[model samples]
Target: MSDEGRLIAGRYRLIERIGRGGMGTVWRAEDEALGREIALKRLHAQQHLSEDELATVHERTRREARSAARIAHPNVVVVHDVLDDEGLPCIVMEYVHGTTLGALLKGGGALPPGEAARVGLGMVAALRAAHAAGVLHRDVKPGNVLLGGNGRVVLTDFGIAMATGTSTLTKTGEIIGSIDYIAPERMRGHKPGPTADLWALGATLFQSVEGRPPFRRATAMETAYAIAVDPLAPMKQAGPLEPLIEMLLAKDPDERPSAEETERALRVVASEAPGATMGTATGGTTEVAWASAVPSRATATVAATGPTTSAGATLTDSGSGSVPPTPISGGGSGSAGDGTGRPRRKRRRLLWSAAAVTLAAAAVAGGLYAVTADDGGHGRKGSGTATAPTASEPSPVPAGFRLVREKTLGVTFPVPDGWKRDGRASAEQVTYTDPSGLVGLTIGTVNPAGANPESHFQNIEANTKLNYSTYRKLRMQRTTFQGKPAAVWEFTFQGQVRAFRAIDFGFGEEGGTEYDIYLSAPEAQWDTHRPVFDTVKAGFRVG
Candidate 1:
């Protein structure tokens, strides 16, 4: 019978069925009391299951609501209330106006690398929030991801999520997840952890950019085998995301990059995405890409032989009732080693030199410029003399520019009219970011200046190189600023999704206060944005 127009809990009146998955049916409903629309999920009835099994399902439904409730993040869907109606559990969720990433991919072949990175950033943000709350989103496939019309990429459906310290709902030796997205370790019956979710995210990203899952076979059993034993299918269009995806899909969880590193990498890529902006309300047919309900498939269940050692044979069950041990192969493309005997962890560093070369070529072709302090209109390269008015003596703000005086940092500088102060500013430093969030200008102070500014920058560069796989130095040299010992350091590094160029000018006397003026922007647009740095430098003043 149709449940249309039915009132549940004497409050929610069902409007229409929006989605149906294995576990439940979601309805667009009106909360008459609250006067707002909500999504209500009614647990699917399994009449054939025993009483005990039914109770387990009920408990899992409750846990799903609880698991999602624990996390309060913008990227995660909001769970409002849980109600018991006619002995079945119904969950009320914030109705999102958008479509699933799966639906978008199905309708549109594949997203461009930059656009895919933009979506990946939202997904990673949701995952990070979940992990921080000790929750594991075991089922993180594209179908469960909601793209809201307001430009919010949300991760929904915590139906199979497992919070830390929670007991397993499924029986021993049984795996519950989409076969194609299952992590290799999970396929081997190892205890799934945060890395397992990351593995699924990698697979999701692969599909987003490549238009198909990494592993797809004729049958579920064969797909399982591919995930656990087969080499990763070669990628054709992953672009900058290829290396990160390869590392995330490594069979060994230890080989995967941490969530923090993944976010940084994704941000770098998303920064370069054309027309990439979150939280903007879109309309018309384009709204379909942001929000709409898509059918959710039930997670498949497969029986495994038993837990095996990391080096032991993997056991999988074929639907024909045969259980066989799949011997672990050595040095496949999917293995932790990148086919060259070098561990995948070290491969990211190799990208640094190559990216550096590309950035250098682009800069040269684009006529890269540098920030220079005015010196009687003599355009000597890397001029460090300060001619701008001091903080005590303010000068006229140039057209299309605004002078910002920061008392905490004891400095004043001119920034583009549209740039706004970043919330990350603190007592130590102040930063203003462009509207696009890609470029930034920062003014900071060092209480005790170092013996030499150049040496201090070199020390900092050493650490930056270690953390950033694509860090490349253009120059680090000693100079004079306002008759004070100073240094100018310039370099380029790959952000989570794109390349960026940065320059820093530090000037001060030994044992006295040091001032730092820094600017960074997209390497591709460096030529056009480079003059902003020059403006800031020309107008920079210290007390």
Candidate 2:
């Protein structure tokens, strides 16, 4: 039997070798401490290095372990313990049961749009969190993405990710991560920053959807050429994804859409996702962090185009580049500008849907025809202008189809593809259900401006029409969402547990502030669908 198969560090009994990478060996092990499974990554202790050299290597490993432990993100692999056995270091991490994106791609080709969007969104969200904590994931390629049990997507192997604000343990100007995914500027010996990771994400997203990277070369020089000199080839099978692929693969790091933009854009396709968040029962990561709060040109579009898109609007970051707070044009001007991903002043005060109505209002309220009374200006009695009152039309619904609507206490949304939306309009609530009766898509909207999410939850419990008493008993609790402060509520209803997960923001919905909340189904399906709320939750943006 090989030494690799032997157990190490006493309690972690190695069952078998699952994988081998350049830096470590991963073994399926029993964590007797918790009596659950874990991935034990041990440095090649048997390698031919001197005792002092071994000590130095393990010292670096320990530093990485400490760095990784502080991440505390769902997308990044969770590191449970670092053990020293026989003077060598071993890291115990959460064991992921699903295949890596690399393995998935090796067996086949590009992923479909929804799956691709899901993966891309997960990766971007992970990078955003990491960057906020001042860490740069130098090695952010597909091989490092781990699909965990419970369909959780995690970015792994933070061994090379380093803190950005200071020159810590890592060597100065020492390039790390994969060579193939390195940004062109970094390849030329420039200091790597958040932008570098964005470039890598573009490369990774391209490969995930097109079956090949944006650049491929037999030699390092040719690889650099592909990234530096040549224009990226249009991804063959990527359709509407053309926009995302273009943004992710943009040559200028600054031009790439922020991680938030990528995630928001993905929601259009992911909204109809039938299963788990990604629905594949696993996850992966491979993107970089955006620079700051302002919207970048890559993600922001001028409103010369129509206001409504099947995809949702981008939310600006709250940091350095945030858009200035000011009102623009008649309520929402004809266009919205983006700064560091925030909604420009013009896009404020209305979710994109209201913009449609506003446009029509603009057309109807023009000039003397405004003189018409409450009956509408169309052929007003004795008014000088009877010119077939110009009407601004909303986009056409498909033939033989009528749009349905749904809502909860304070929130409402349109059902696009016949999930049979049914709910109240003016009362500020909505609900949706497909034929199968699995999902209880209930929503509550509130313009709780002066109140925080906590007080607002209390308000929701008191006013909701169904199970108000039981819901009040659940009581809202605060918890971490990805990296944001979030509120959650768990309750029992009719022999099943129901959980609501939400993050609060002052949204411009229907000319008011809204809580923009989401609730998972009863317990029978909670485990199956709760993750979907996160996907939908990310789509909620405030201008």
Candidate 3:
């Protein structure tokens, strides 16, 4: 049984699921033998597979897990063990507590250029390590990258990774990987090399800063066509990293910068961002390559603000007064990447090959996909009707509760003495946790996408029902609180360690600003924690 509470291989106890993707469901499991927590990835029973196809997938899973296990690096997720559990292959890996890059993007749109550069550097290192180990990560996208709690970037889910000199498992004309990030060479049936991974990295970086893929379209065909034939969309937010992005994204394999050169450029970008620090870059360094001699407008802006280092390079600060120009080695004036000379025909080849390969991959595998759930309960709001409430004044605060005011969200409430906010508030979201993680309170603003409190609950429920295990809704109704339109939604769902009972109160304020107050606790202790919800609601006020 793959259900919760079932033991895999009579050793790893299945905990609640942490994530799911095209390859399998990822669970936080307990290793009974070692008394340690770990992550378990179990193969999914794909609906499109036959008996033979299932066998092929199983073999591929085993091989890929073993291959990934051979790679050892801090930026790479460590694979602990591989086991056959009830005919399904399961991989045991280190349990990481954090969110994926995709989740971070969805929660707060595009990231700042410096932050994106930091993230890109980590992925580049992971790719470097895997490449050194003679492995090619066929799939490199935001969903596969993890941001750890300790501020580490980890690359995982090598389900389609191919080793060096290996025969192709994909049928003729069939390609894998996220379509938007696939290299032009791979689309043309050419064997993918390390340079291909570099191209995907460039695409990932582009999406990170621009809030969307460089070649996104309404349909697969159109998107593939765009990737192959169209010029890259102009980047307004890339800042100092535009030159690096252009160089990595060169259509021809030989034209693209090496991994070493790419890492150096990304590090320079990360290092130059205000208040941004560079992460550790492993492996040997490569000589810096110049994409252009004249600085682009964005590059000049970055150079005007900070010092940069490269081999035999010089920086002339144009008196922007941000920072004194300090040249380290090989550093020179910034330049436009695409402005450098390169044959335009390579882009055309890339375009046609990408279209052909994308069509074949879509037809055969139904397309490569990854499903990521937002972990922090930061959901969007829905639309509804407004009704005035009958009450105005709030009830007395429960004894021992203290009022805490959030000036940013312009509201305040009584928090239990022991409950404390997790870190200072930023982005208008504040979370308070009890001594245990099992119970917590979250208050934040949802996108006022024409959503009223009641309809918003329903829209969120639809998504939760699809992802949460055994999710049961008890009540979701429109009501009034503190003379404002409000909705209350209460439900129960299974978490990684226990069943949770949650209650949310969403209040609509003027200018379509919606505030949500949510509290969740272990279901077994719902009664004990229920009073806190009332305490918060009675004292809740909008300023």
Candidate 4:
């Protein structure tokens, strides 16, 4: 029978179906007593399930309510009640009149860096609250994030949440959650901590700015493999939010930054985003337009084979190959059928096992390669004798500036008279700072220049975006310097206490030495200090 207009428990009436997913159906319902709209999720009927399986599903539904109700935060969706109707469990929650992050991204494309940082701030806050309550939202994805019309960004859907002391409610050899967002440790069968959720947050942020998951691949198995061992795919548009995202996606959970650090980083970016307004933990202002969209409440579950071990196992989806479930065991044989009772596919036992082995091998190989690699005679800064400039004779030093030669890089540039070289100067680069330490100039080189200087700058900018918050690009373009191919990149980024602007000029031929001259100063003093870069560039010479 159609569930529309059906009243369960004689108090709440289901008015319309708002969304459906693999595990349940969500309804837009009216709380007759309170005269307010509420969202109700009812477990799907599974007549074919054995009594044990049915009971497990029922318990999971109740647990979801309990897990979410434990956290009382504005960024977390409110769970009003859980009830029984027609032998099924139904959860009543606040009816958010907004679109999901996933739907918004799908329809409108990726968000700007600042906007994404705002969204991330909300998510991390919710996560902090959940963790404080001893709740682990194992499934953190874009689909589960809601942006309310009232300028609130909320995290929803605790279907797979694991409360600290509660039983897993999962079958042996079963791993439940979104495949792409699952942490690598979880995929390897190790227990998850708060960092697991942080990893998912990273993937969500990556999608928010780049329009795709960092390690996404064609099939579930391939995606799992990539997440387990592949190098992070290059990012093109993450801007200032890239660094935190990369940190969150670290393969080792311990290596990921703590929630407090993550939130602080996100706040820095959000504060500087255009049209951004800070929001309190209770409820805050957002710049995004919310749509009337709701995501389905289904959680993807994959079954695996072998005894669960600390190392983890491989996983296989029931029938749909779209988003495969993560593995839970190292090896064994099992058959998973599409819920249809048709023939099941034999489990691939060696999938994750092989991936783990390959990962270890690659790591070792990479270490060995780094140790054996040759670095051309550009030894440590003080280890070698200085080489004189080769391109041209010294030009007259401008007033208030002095000619400085970097022996290691065989380059000369004009430095403001009061600047001093920093102690951390190395063979590859040297940095000099003005008396206030708010301004700096660095001269560096690349042994084998890339195909072009502009592309090289772009590559460096990608990493810079990850490292610096509130990083804003002014210009990156190709030009000529002394008749050699060169590029200039300019941008501003947030420093410890203030914002700083920077400009870099690099030039050389492919496979030859490339020289880089960079300058940075406090944004407020940029205009006053800008002329220093011009004077230095005019006098810069390379051998």
Scored by lDDT, the top model is 1
**How many clashes show up per model?**
15, 25, 15, 7
Residue pairs in collision within model 4: 188-311, 188-312, 189-312, 243-466, 313-329, 314-327, 315-327
lDDT of 1 by residue, 1-543 (tens): 478989999999999898898878999999999999999999988898899999999998899999999999999999999989899999999999988899998853688888888888889999999999999999999898899998889998888889999998987546787877888766655578898999999999999999988877544544554565444666899876776787677655655667876776676556545675643333333222211111111111111121111111112222222121111111112223433566544543343223323221211000001111112223533442346445456644678999888885577778899887754343445556676666656565554566766755654444334323456777777877667887777666543345556666777788776676666666787767767766776777786
Candidate 2 vs 4: which has more TM-score: 4
* Model 2 C-alpha lDDT per residue in residues 1-543, reported as the tens digit of each score: 375446666667788788898778888888776799888888876578767666667776776676678777888778889988776688888888987887776744778766776787778788888888778887788887776556567888777666755444433334456766877455333456776777787777778888876766443333443343234565676654555666555433444556666665565445434563433222222111111121222211111000100010111112221111000001111122332253332332232224123222211110000000011112322222222111132322333333333321322223324444432122223334433433433333333232233333333333221212222233445433223333443333221122222112222223343333333233454545444333333332222
Q: By TM-score, is 1 or 2 better?
A: 1
RMSD of each predicted structure: 24.0, 24.6, 21.1, 22.1
Ranking according to TM-score, highest score first: 1, 4, 3, 2
The lowest-lDDT stretch of 10 consecutive residues in candidate 2 is 365-374
For model 4, residues 42-79, the per-residue Cα lDDT tens digits are 99999899999999989988989999999999999999
TM-score of 2: 0.49
TM-score, structure 1 vs. true: 0.54
Give me the runs in candidate 3 sitting further than 4 Å from their true place.
279-543
Please write out the lDDT profile of model 3 over residues 1-543, one tens digit for every residue: 348888888889988998887778899989999999999999887778888889878877887787688899999999999988778898999998899998877743798888998999899999999999999988898888999988899999888898877665776556677888887556444577888889899988988998888767544433443343233556899886776786566544555566876776677667666776554432222112222311121111111001111100011122221111111111111111222252323432242334223322211100010000111122322111122222344434567787887795576777888876655232334556666545666555543322446655554454334323356777777765555566777766543344556666666654465666666666788778766666565566667
Residue 16 of candidate 3: its Cα lDDT? 93
Predicted candidate 4, C-alpha RMSD: 22.1
